[model samples]
Target: MYSVVVEANVQYEKESFTIVGLPVVPIKKSKECILSYQHTLGIDITMKKITIHLSPADASPPSQPN
Candidate 1:
């Protein structure tokens, strides 16, 4: 089993999106998902600096021997 902690910080001064603490592939995908979800609700995140962090980043799912 694995655990991940997600945190988001939004700032109105600049337009930037960043993810920290983890290097998972899906983290990139999360940007797309957030964009789509925001679009659905008519929210503009373009002028905001968004920061996402994943804690316990070293944790990974348990693997089973084949």
Candidate 2:
């Protein structure tokens, strides 16, 4: 199994969160994960903007044989 490193940056900017250097699917899901975790911990991040980046941006998951 291969491991990937993800970097997260939190900024005090307009309410927006983004995941860079990743495909559309994971980017979309990232928000869900963040929101879910924050909700579980009762942490309010409504006013903050969060950004996440995946290292080795070109890296991709191995393909599966059908």
Candidate 3:
């Protein structure tokens, strides 16, 4: 297991993050993808502040954006 924090997208808002309890490069990339979309497709937001956690075979952390 591992813990990795990364900024991600929200409900058409700025970016949050996903705390990876068992993260890797791909996991971090995934979070980045969400952040990008949020900055592009989602609403107008730019808050690189969030946390992500990864478990057995997935990442789970706090709720949506802050």
Candidate 4:
């Protein structure tokens, strides 16, 4: 099985949420879910810029040795 690393960075700049490293549409669409959960947890991050990076966005099979 392949593995992927997820990293996040929140900046105090213009309110925006971006997911890099070639995320799928569902991953990109998670902002709404995240916001909802944050609201439920009483966490206020409305003015922060949230960036999520998925390391090794493209996963390929291991190289075959000769």
Instruction: Quantify all predictions' global Cα lDDT against the true fold.
Output: 0.77, 0.73, 0.55, 0.73
Sorted by TM-score (best first), the order is: 2, 1, 4, 3
Cα lDDT of candidate 3 equals 0.55
Best by TM-score: 2
TM-score of each: 0.60, 0.61, 0.35, 0.55
Residue lDDT tens for model 2, 1-66 = 335567888878788777776678876776687678879999766777888776453577557999
True lDDT of residue 49, candidate 1: 93
Off by over 4 Å in 4: 1-5, 55-66
The candidate 1 region of ten consecutive residues with least summed lDDT is: 53-62
Worst 10 residues of 4 by lDDT: 53-62
Better of 1 and 4 by TM-score: 1
Model 1 quality (TM-score): 0.60
Off by over 4 Å in 2: 56-66
- The true-structure Cα RMSD of candidate 3 reads 8.6
What is the C-alpha lDDT profile of model 4 across 20-52, one tens digit per residue?
A: 665587565565666677799998777899887
lDDT of 3 by residue, 1-66 (tens): 445454433443356556454438777776676567768876544555455443443445548886
The 10-residue segment with the lowest total lDDT in model 3: 4-13
